[model samples]
Target: MLAFKVTTVGASSGFILTKEAMAKLNVKKGDTVFLTDAPGGGFRLTPYNPDFERQMALAEDVMRADRDILRALAK
Candidate 1:
């Protein structure tokens, strides 16, 4: 696991990732990455996905069969 310290960025807080971590996330400078809280109470970061449309197509079928519960999740 990689450890990061919260650092100041012009009056806001941010974490700095090393070049290796950036490579693993498939992103470069100014690219958006998501940071979500883990089940164990830590944080997880990942690249913003491009295949979401395809995944949503599959989810739409499931959502239609059920209710729109899937929409409860924030995009």
Candidate 2:
């Protein structure tokens, strides 16, 4: 597991991403990260939100369910 320090950002708060962590995430300065509540109680950081992923998965399921209809129309 990795740990990060919460630092003060003038009036707000933020964390520092080390070079190693940045490398692991394949991102650089000006990039964005998503933070949300973890399962237990803490927080989590993500490149993509789980909610968005869930919606995308639902869309994929709908498309897959109509695959035969799509193929017939594509012909």
Candidate 3:
């Protein structure tokens, strides 16, 4: 497990990720990472957005269902 030190960031608390952690997460400086609740009372950290994935899935469904109409509209 990787450990991080909590530090104060101008009145807010933040943690510094080590180089190894950043590499494992495949993230770089200025990149956005999300911390989400996991099963069994743990947390998950990932660079992907779950909500955006869901939204994109829904959009794909709509696009597939309306392919004929969409094709006509493109003309």
Candidate 4:
């Protein structure tokens, strides 16, 4: 399910990402893609970001869990 067409770049229109969708969205050229907006409305390109958020959430959880240790270190 890959279909991109859009054209017209000078005026602000893109979507050329071929090459097997930039190698499964690994990105290369400019590197940085994140449409995001899935769920029911549909729309999710993503070259990361979401993952960063998830990682940040996990980090926060760990920090919270070890708050006591951190406080002790601070003092």
Error of 1 at 45 (Å): 0.9
Backbone clashes in model 3, listed as residue pairs: none
Q: What is candidate 2's CA lDDT for residue 45?
A: 78
lDDT of each residue in 3-42, candidate 1, tens digit only: 7799999999998989888888889999988776768899
Instruction: Quantify all predictions' global Cα lDDT against the true fold.
Output: 0.78, 0.87, 0.95, 0.89
Worst 10 residues of 3 by lDDT: 45-54
> Where's the lowest-lDDT run of ten residues in candidate 1?
66-75
| Candidate 1, residue 22: lDDT | 86
Q: Best-fitting candidate, measured by lDDT?
A: 3
Cα lDDT of candidate 3 equals: 0.95
Give lDDT tens digits, candidate 2, residues 1-75. Answer: 678889999999988899989888777899878888999999877777688899999999988999999889999
Query: Candidate 2 clashing pairs?
Result: none
Better of 2 and 4 by lDDT: 4
Kindly list the per-residue Cα lDDT of model 4 for residues 1-75, writing each as its tens digit.
789888899979887988998999889898888888899998889788887889999999999999999899999
What are the C-alpha RMSDs, in order, of all predicted structures? Answer: 8.8, 2.2, 1.4, 10.1
Model 1 ranges off by over 4 Å: 39-42, 49-55, 58-75
